[model samples]
Target chain A: MSETMKAAIFVKPGEMTVREVPKARIEQVGDAVVRVVRACVCGSDLWYFRGLSAHPHNSQIGHEAIGVVDEVADAVTSVRPGDFVVLPFPYSCGTCPVCRAGFESVCPHGGYFGASQAEYVRVPEADGTVVKVPGSPEDYDDETLASLLTIADVMSTGYHAAVSAEVRPGDTAVVMGDGAVGLCGVLSARMLGAGRIIAMSRHEDRAALAREFGATDIVAERDQAAVDRVLSMTGGYGADAVLECVGSRQSFDTALGLIRRGGVIGRVGLPHDVEISAEGTFYGNIGIKGGPAPVRHYDLEAGLLDAVLERRIDPGRVFTGIYDLDQIQAAYEAMDRREVIKSLIRF
Target chain B: MSETMKAAIFVKPGEMTVREVPKARIEQVGDAVVRVVRACVCGSDLWYFRGLSAHPHNSQIGHEAIGVVDEVADAVTSVRPGDFVVLPFPYSCGTCPVCRAGFESVCPHGGYFGASQAEYVRVPEADGTVVKVPGSPEDYDDETLASLLTIADVMSTGYHAAVSAEVRPGDTAVVMGDGAVGLCGVLSARMLGAGRIIAMSRHEDRAALAREFGATDIVAERDQAAVDRVLSMTGGYGADAVLECVGSRQSFDTALGLIRRGGVIGRVGLPHDVEISAEGTFYGNIGIKGGPAPVRHYDLEAGLLDAVLERRIDPGRVFTGIYDLDQIQAAYEAMDRREVIKSLIRF
Candidate 1:
């Protein structure tokens, strides 16, 4: 085993570099070292790279990945060396109160894995953090593998949005954003039995993928125009549930405009400068609910892994571009340019 | 009956005068004129009186009341003349889409009853707007009548808060105001099976009433101190659900600080100047759901009317002071001075 391994390192705004770094080891009683098999860029990663938000220079940059367990500490028993696993972004002590309440992402004993986009990643609380796959990495094909990778973040996030919105069986669900999460939101709404899934996207490619994922309608408009179009379509009643995937003020406002009285908004995008006035929401009887995806909770609840493994959804189609460790910078650049819906990096 | 009757009129900021105004009569096909038997001042009414918010000069005031049906249009059949009833603040058509969804408060065809404190109130959509109390006013005692009056607004609003917060058995529920609505919220939480109900109050009288309303604990501290006390009380985990009965920024912020991860906030107070950041709520996996109470929904669903009639709750005790129509100004002043938790006006 090598003492050093290649990893993606944040250099500065708009740049990430792949270089050899110290290999991860079992540092705690419950730690496990997983050799990366797949990793992906998140929309939030683009935000950090664009400096819309700050990121520490030289910090390990990724938070989603799938890998094979290389080692586990003596106290870790959930998985063993050679076991294939899916790593949720946040490492949590699943026994904590927050975790017990199905919010492991915000568990007091949990923290993010900022270094998942690397050759080897140290997973703390391994017994609670790494989800063991039924077989080794080769047990699934490339598409299945990519779909499994999404269970770490985007897909689960989309599912969370749908769940938070309380999407009903015959609801008219409006999804804002054309990104991977939004497409998955379409899939999730469909999975949850939404009668009408409307995808708000201008990009033809993303819109098509959204349809494939289960969008019954597509509105290529933005802001108030989109709101008008949707309201007109629904007899001026607006949607029953709105999945807000873009966390900008405008997106939030658009969401507010696109819901019927007593409708709900499930917001999954990490909000950037959005302020919801309680008075503004009072008259409409609007309900706002969502947060960072508790991917682990879903994994344990309904099994996103099983859904992918069983081919119930083909979310891997979101990876319009793929790359290797050497092409890390290009992956970020391609996604930043919107040249790809998402970039999946192979180990 | 006289063509004119005494009513409370909003003369201007800080002045509400009782004067002879034209008595209400059936104005629409769905209308019913109710002779006021009992009416009360709401905290929001105080807000209107204090000029914190605008109300047209010389306009009719008051929305909570119980009365006898004086007359009903040919199109109305829910209640006949001489039938006792509780009038919800908003008069909604029974069949509107929003009304059918249980949010009659924001029904497009619905509107406020600004003249309820007067001699007679013309309730539109009488079949839907007026909840028949089974018999005439003489059948119930004064306490039951007062509690029935609360069903028109405060009690239902408080119950909506608990329902929105998704209060569960064995959960710690926090009520964020000491006013009538908050007191009712404490009672509502207990009704919903909350094992621990914490009422945030500093007033000795209100605190005692909160205890009587099933508040197992009381935190007189405000802001950070209150948050700290609650955190310590629950082993620094905070309450599972927070009912925000005060819509001020401080109250909302305190509610945020007092909830555990995955906790929810149910806000019913008419929000003043509160702005909630999506970013602030995202990290905690928090949920917010509340609006103007769908009082009619509660009335139709679990029968808040039945709850009062059955003595399952004694929310009428929230009326700490009572007055006649001539003391209308004094009723407002008493609540403003914190000398009374709430005031009821007898016709």
Candidate 2:
């Protein structure tokens, strides 16, 4: 193993530099050293780089990945050398009250890895956070594994939105975004047995993917017109459930407007601020369920690893752009310019 | 029967005049003439008298009452002459789609009676809107029936708020406001098996009755302090459910602050124009459920009639003041001065 690993480091906001840094080592008792097989960029990561977030400068960058367990501490019993696993974005001890209640993402003592976007990562609580991939071909393939990376964050987030929305069988759901998370919401709604899935998007390319993911209808319009279209499609009763994948006020209003008198609205977008009218929500009998997506609760990394090995849901299609670790700045720029759905960093 | 009956008419806002008006005759196919034994003023009726509502001048003055069927139209088959019945505040046709879905109060064709505050009231959709009191004595009684009149409006409204709040057995509920609706909320919470009921009140008299009606705790304070007290009583987790019975901004904010995470906040008060913060509701996972109370949906009038006959719930305690038919202005004055929880007019 090399003493140094290449990493895409953010020296400051809007600045990314490829540097050879000392490889991550097992720092805690339950830590496991994994050789990163693949890592991807997320919309939230861009927030930090674009100076929109309060994240400290030079902080570790990415939070999504799939890797092999190259080393484990004495206290770690879940994985060993040569085992393939996916890391949950939020590293949870998996033994807190919130975790026991199935809300792991909000674990009181959880944090994330990939602070430096490196070739290798040290995962804390390895036994509790990493899920092993079964029946893997010995060779690590980027395409197959890239999809698994989504399970670590965005995919699980979409699942959270569906769960919060309480999407039941025979329900109609409207997803209000065309981002990766929104696309995953379309898939989640289908998996949850929503009879009708409406994806609200103006992007033709993304809308096509949403349809492939089982969207029964695509609302190309935005705002009030989009809400009207959704109501028109649902026999004037509005959708039974709405997923506010975009946290903007406009998206929230659309979700609220498209839901029926007794429907649920689940939100997962990290907006700067969102406000709802009491009169409107109360008069319409609308209920809202959302907060931070409890990614740890769904244990997506573990579940997706098994699902991926068994050829269930494909998440790799979300990755529309890829770049070498040194080209991290260009990746962020492309994503910001809406040139790609998502960008990935290759070691 | 006499060709005319004593009635109270609102000549203008804040003034009422009593005169001999022709006894109501059966005009609609389903209309039934009821000889009113008792009728009471409602808080909502005050809005019309104060010119805050769009009610026409000289319209009927009351909507809550217990009466006997004096005459029945050919189409009315549910009740016969001399049958003791309770009239639901809002008359529902009971066959509309909204009514069939258990939202009778919001029925498109539903309307209220007692436009003249008359001794003989005409009820529409008699077969569907009036419920006869079972096992009642042959002689008509006013006091006992007056207590049951609460179910026609305020009691039903309170029950709706509690139901919307999802008040379940062993849950703690906080009721905002000390009005008749708030008192009814205390009883409704008890009926719903709430583990603890906290009634917010500033009036000592109302607070006393609140306890009698089953409020386990009383927070006489208002605003933030009241919210803190409610939270303190619930071990800092906030109540499991909260009923916003007041329409003011302060009441709404207090209700919002008293509910726990993932808790329900049911609001039944009609607000003029209040801006509810969507971000505040979304980030906490709070669920809001409520609109206008479906008083006609749950057979409230029937239930109350039976309760009155059985001496189960006493609604008459709400009436603290009474006046002759011609003294309607005094009744309103007393209510405005907070000298009475409710007022009644006698001919």
Candidate 3:
């Protein structure tokens, strides 16, 4: 292993630069070193780059990744050298009472990896955070791995929204965004037995993909009109469940208005200083279940990898543009211009 | 039956006058005529009497009662003549799907009884709305029956709040408001298996009853300090469930703030405007389950009668003042002055 490895670092707000940094090494007995195969930019990742987040400057810039286990410490037993693995973005010890209760995302001892986007990453609690991919071809390609990368973060977030919404068979679920997480919510709702999945998207392209991913309907309206469309489609009873995938106030209002009485609203959107009306929610008997996308709770690294291996869900479609590690700024520019659904960086 | 019966009539706001009206006769096939043994005034009834409600003038006031079945219609089979029964305030047919689902308070064919405080009340859907008292004693008295009268309204509202809050065994529940409903909430929480019950009351006398009824703690504070007091008692975790028994905005905020994360807030308070902020409710993942009291859902008439018969709860403590059929105005004035928890009008 080289003493210094290539990493993409956020030098300042709205800037990314490639640099050779000391490769991540096992700092704890439960840690492991993984060689990155593919990593992608997430919508939240953009928040830091756009100066909207409180993240420190010159920090590691990516979180979603699929990699090969290069080395494991004495305490690590889940994966070995040369094994393909998917890493949960927010690493968890996965042995706490909360994790035992299947809420590992909020595990007390969890920490995130890839603070500086490097080729080799150090994963804490490797036995619990990394899931070895099974039955992979000898020469697996980057796109397949990049698509699988999403399960570590955004895809898992979408799945969490679906689960929290209590999407059941013959129930209508409305997704309130068209981003990567929203698209995954469309797929997750279908997988969870939602009879009719409505994806609210203004873009024709995203709406088309949502349809292909099992969205039964697409409501192109926003705000009050969007609520009216959902109500009309459900015979005035309103959707049985609603998924708020966007953190904006408009999306929150739309999700609340689209659900019926006694309905559940699963909100996974991360917002800055968001407030919900107490009286409005109380009178409607609306139940809300969500926070910070409990990525570890869903065991995304393992469950999502199996889905990829079975070809049950194709998340790689989220990555529309790819760039070598040196073209990181160009990748961000394309994503900012909305020219790509997601941009990937290759080693 | 007499040709004319003594009845209490609210001819104008803040005044009640007794008038001779024709005795109520069984009009519907399923109806029964109940000779009122005891009746009580409710806070909501005062709203109408004070002209603060949307109800029209000359509307029959007073919905709580315990009475004897004097006559049964042709189709009536649940109760027979001489049977002492407790009437559910909102008369439900009890055969609709909603009623079948145990939401009888919102029964499609249900409506309130006693257009005027009459001596004989014609109860519609008698088979569904009336519960025959078990083991009638030879010496049946008004005090025992008067306490049982609350089962029809305030007591039921309190029970509904606890049920909607999903108060479970070993959980802490906070009841907001020191009104009759709030005091009843303390009893309901005990019945529902709440390990720790916190009653928020400004009145020391009501707080004492709350404790006697099984409240483990008393929060005399009203505003944000009350919320802090509840949190302080719960080790900063907040109550596992909260009952919003008061309809004011302050009570609403107190209830919302008193509940822990993932806690349920049951709101039975009927607000005039029904307005609440969305931001405060959305982020916490709190669930709310209630609007108007579902008096019919829990078979309050039967349940409360059973409780009374078994000597489990005594609502008579709430009735601190009593008046004749003609002293209704003074009764209202006394209640307004907070000199009485509840005032009963004897016909």
* Highest TM-score scorer: 1
- lDDT of candidate 3 over B224-310, digit per residue (tens): 899888878876757888988887777877777777755668878776554544444544546666655556555443376677666
Residue B109, candidate 1: how far off, in angstroms? 2.2
Estimate every model's Cα lDDT from 0 to 1.
0.90, 0.77, 0.76
Query: Best candidate, DockQ-wise?
Result: 1
For each of the candidates, what fraction of the native contacts does it recover? 0.86, 0.44, 0.32
Each model's Cα RMSD: 2.0, 5.7, 6.1
Question: A87, model 2: CA deviation in Å?
Answer: 6.5
Clashing pairs in 1: none
**Which of the predicted structures, 1 or 3, would earn the higher DockQ when compared with the native?**
1
Report the lDDT tens digits of candidate 2 across residue range A34-153. Answer: 888778788877777888777766655787877788899999987899898877777768765345445555454666665526788889988777867764525646667777777778
lDDT by residue (tens digit), candidate 1, B9-113: 888988878999788887889989999999999999988888898889998899999999999999997789999999999888878667777888888788888
True contacts kept of 2: 0.44
Candidate 3 structure, TM-score to reference: 0.73
List chain A TM-scores, every candidate, in order. Answer: 0.98, 0.91, 0.94
